[model samples]
Target: MSSQETEVLVVGAGQAGVAMSQHLTERGIPHLVLERDRIAERWRTGRWDSLVANGPAWHDRFPGLEFDDVEPNAFAPKERVADYFEAYAKKYNAPIRTGVEVTSVRRKDGESGFRVETSDGTVNARYVVAATGPFQKPVIPAVVPDTQGLAQIHSSAYHNPQQLPDGAVLVVGAGSSGVQIAEELQRSGRQVFLSVGPHDRPPRQYRGKDFCWWLGVLGKWEMAAPPKGAEHVTIAVSGANGGHTVDFRALAAAGITLVGRTNSFNNGTMHFASDLGRNIAAGDANYLSVLDEADLYIARNGLDFPEEPEARVLGDNPACVTKPLLELDLGAAGVTSIVWATGFAVDYSWLQVDDAIDAEGRPRHQRGVSTEPGIYFLGLPWQSRRGSSFIWGVWHDAGYVADQITIQRGYAAHVADVPLRQAATSAQSHTELSERIAVTQGA
Candidate 1:
């Protein structure tokens, strides 16, 4: 196979990879971006027609481009976002090798480089950026047993509700994707059933402030070191307004029925959690409480005011009435389609890196730097700040990592930064010493 060389090799050409490529180009660094398919293929092919960004347009912009339109704070459609990404790639002249499937990435021992073998050829690069997003794989639960008669499709495969067969369809998972799919199917003259699960709920706006405003105020978007006790916890909470919110009241207003969480499936019927409504109610309340606390904190801090609070009605409490998992008896309900809005998973089998990822399948990185030297990760949830994984957040992280890359290159005479393992130990010692000093002073 032909061989090539570059300063860096980016594995995916989505938002993160494109953002990194922009930074490298601006810095005059030589980098090659390899993509398995055309850029923004996921956004183009993997989403539904009615899907809009869960966050506002401002939250969806990349490094140099702004997603400004006449409607401020509006949800941008998937196609529009994909178009923007295409424009971004063209604008930056990103060195993208499309249709090149990367089969394996093997790091060379005793050398600060990696061999990336792709369908086209092999390339050795000093650094590798795994810009392949967390949503590389579609997650379908193993408990969802085989259905010989029922026509089932994951949300990834579903483009429109019209693709489903005739009859009542059961949608498993109550996340944003699931809710939207169920709503769309119901609107398409099909009887739709949903399986509830642990989900977050926040008002579209609170006191004249958008939900993102509250997240910004509560340090949820702040880039601080991970909390002492919450090492495993990721700070970035999904913005409530951007995705589908099951306004139970609105659903009731529209005459749509609610159902319980799916536990298992057997004999063509799905089992559900007994306390599904109670769990959903508790989840909604808990999210609201968090937002309320955030609002209170913002007010106390004397942040700038936008306007008077807007009048909005919270959804009805799901606790008053509980519904068992509405098993769509396909024959009786005439169910035609079942859309699995179950979330996604990350697959790193192609990359030959060891002990670099955690048990949860998340890369073990302090701030984008993985355990293996020269193997860095960006655009992960809570990678740097709360927004690092976001379109806006990637820029800042990219800049830092770019700087780190420059320093490591010895192009600039700055010392290479210490690894996360060393940094964490130092931080722990500093905290211990501070506690001792406080005790002595108090005594």
Candidate 2:
């Protein structure tokens, strides 16, 4: 196999890796990015066909580039997002090698750098940034039993309603992905059952502003952690059909049955927790809390946004919640498919650097700086803040990680004059908008 050398080697050419390359390039740092597939491979192949970005184009995009040709307020489709990443990489001429998968990364023996082994060849680099992102492995709960003929798929593998087998479909998990998939399947004439779980229900728009805009302005996105009792609650909002709220009651009204969380699958029967009412109530409380926060922000600043009366309405309980089903026999219910909208897990088996990761195989870092020198991580959820996993947030994190690399490489003077975060701020189209985002890094 062929071998190569570089100052820095970045794995995964997704948003995080590309963003790292962009920052490294800005600093005149010599780096090469490797990807197992095409640029933005996850967006191209891992998402559902009807999926769109959760955040508006204006808010969730890289600095120096708006989503290409898409409206600022609109949530670009999956394809558009992938296209935008490809375009962004091209604009900077990022040194990316697609289809080259990094199989192992370890510190070189008696050396200060890493010996990177890839599917194609090997790479020796002084620094390595593992930008594989948060969604490395899709996880289905172990409680899901093996069925003889029932079809099941993780949300990442789901393309559209037609991708599943015919007949009723049971969707487990009530996060953004699960609710969106359930709604889509329901709309496509499939009887859908959505398992309710701890979730945050924020309206897509309140008053005259999108929920994302509210989150940013209210400093919600910059929060270090989720609120108390909501550590695992997923945000249940969507950017489909221009944008809309993901109200469980509203979804139930539209013919999607809402059930409690799937507890287990035994003897060909699916068990459910008796927390449907409690879960919905918790989500409703969160929904109200967001509106209350937004209201408080507007009140304090005396903003001129109008009140949205309809958003305050909490309708009657849905049939499923009122008459909760303790157990479900999929065969009898005619449930032919099960879509697991459960989230993902990280895989760091390839990274053999000591002290870089914890006992649980999770990266041990403050921001993106790992405990191990010359090693770094990017694109982790809450890596710096609540927004770290976001598009723009990842860009900022990449900048921070790049700065750390520059400092370690004895090139501090090269970036001493201007910080990359400030540079990105200066490159923004709107000064007010750029100023609103909390800075994740400094020189």
lDDT of each: 0.69, 0.87
lDDT tens digits, residue span 1-443, model 1 = 38998879988988888888888777666789999998977888888777776677766687457775615577788878787887898999999988998899888877668988999999999888888877778877776545547777888888786687677887877666777777777777777777666655655555556566666766677856454544432121233335433465455445455667667766655666666676566556756675567567767988675533332346455432353544544466565556777767787777787756777777877777788777888777778776776677777787767656654554222225634333222223434434533543454
Return the lDDT, model 1, position 62.
71
lDDT of 2 by residue, 1-443 (tens): 49998889999999999899999888667889999999999998999999999999999899998876789999999989998889999999999999899999999998668999999999999899999998999998887656457788999999998888899999999888998899899999999889998888887999889988888898887998766776677888899888898888888888888889899888778899999999999888988998999888889998898878788889899888899898999889899999999999999999998899899989999988899988999999989888997899999899889777755654332256645443332323233322323232233
For each of the candidates, give the backbone clash count. 9, 0
Measured on C-alpha atoms, candidate 1 has an lDDT of 0.69
In order of appearance, the predictions have TM-scores of 0.81, 0.91
